[model samples]
Target: MTQKRISKELQECLTTPPAGIKVNLVDEGNIHNWNIVMDGPADSPYVGGKFQLLLVLPTEYPFKPPKINFKTRIYHPNVTFDEHGSMCIGILKSDSWKPSSRIPNVLTAIQQLLLEPVPDDAVEQGAAQKFKEDRKAFDKEARDMTKKYAK
Candidate 1:
């Protein structure tokens, strides 16, 4: 059941991909993991950067939300700056996630997060505080990080 659903979702994502986002299977035999490449939004600090990400669907997917981590570093309040690059997005939250949610929706939400970081629900508290208190510095740091890490 999990494989069938993953295959179906994978096909749909490949056929009708979201803007600035590209997704591919990590391994031909593994439908559970995906490699994603996303172009940063023009209006954000991450503009002109290409970010890589990993999305992993659990064996009990549809019952549990998929996990996404940035393979590239980003200096946003919602995304961690270290190796983990963990992100905080509303839809991916266990309580907020729904079985109907798709990969495209998740990618789109990520793009929106880059455009406007949700400081209140941030994963990196210092980055969030900087974002709220000093918008310019936050943008500069984010852009610098995007240039350094995000190719």
Candidate 2:
């Protein structure tokens, strides 16, 4: 039942994706896992980059939030450093996630996160510091990393 709901949502997202983002199942048989690629929003530091994330649904999904982790290494304050690429978004976390939220909402939130990072709660301290102290350098590093990974 959970898988069916997720599959239906995936189909809806694929057919009518939010602006500059795409979502699909990681494998045909795995409705519990999804692969998402987001195009950076215009005028943001992440512009021109394609970011990837893995979304894993728990057995009791919708009631429980899905797990989201970045598959592409990015130079972002919200993404973790250890190459694990974990995101520091509120909605993805258990505390803030809502059962009513859909896949499109999650992907949109991620894209918005790229455009405007939540520096107060940062996963990558260095990147967060850079973002706050040196805007140009931060942008450069983010752009460079995007070029390398977001293919």
Candidate 3:
């Protein structure tokens, strides 16, 4: 059941992906893992950067939300500043996630996060502090990191 649903969602994403997002299977033989390439929004500090992400679906998927992690490091309040680049986003949270939610919607939400980060719910405290205290500095640091890591 999970496989069938994932295949349907994958096909839909491939056929009409959200703007600035591209999706592909991580391994041709495995449908459970996906590789995502997301272009940073033009209006954000991450503009001109290309971010890579990994999305893994559990066998019990649809009953559970997919796990998404940034393979490309990003300097954002909601994303940890480490090799792991674990992100904190509401839609991916188990409580907020719904089986009805689709991949495109998830990708769109991520894009929106880039455009407008929620500093109060941040995973990276330093980044959050900078974001809240010094907007210009935050944008500069984010752009610098994007150039360094997301290029």
Overall lDDT per candidate, in order of appearance:
0.92, 0.85, 0.94
TM-score of every candidate relative to the true structure: 0.96, 0.93, 0.98
Clashing pairs in 1: none
Give the winner by lDDT: 1 or 3: 3
- Using alpha carbons, what is the TM-score of model 2? 0.93
| Model 2 segments more than 4 A misplaced | none
Candidate 2 clashes between residue pairs 3 or more apart in a chain or in different chains: none
Q: Give the runs in model 3 whose Cα sits over 4 Å from its true position.
A: none
Rank order by lDDT, top first?
A: 3, 1, 2
Clashing pairs in 3: none
**What is the C-alpha lDDT profile of model 2 across 3-103, one tens digit per residue?**
77877788898899899988888898878888888888898877888888888999899889999888888888988855678987878778888888998
Residues 1-151, model 1: lDDT tens digits = 8888889989988998899989899998999999999999999999999999999999989889999999999998988889998998889999999998888889999999999899998889999999999999999998998889887
Residue 148 Cα positional deviation in candidate 2, in Å, after optimal superposition: 2.0
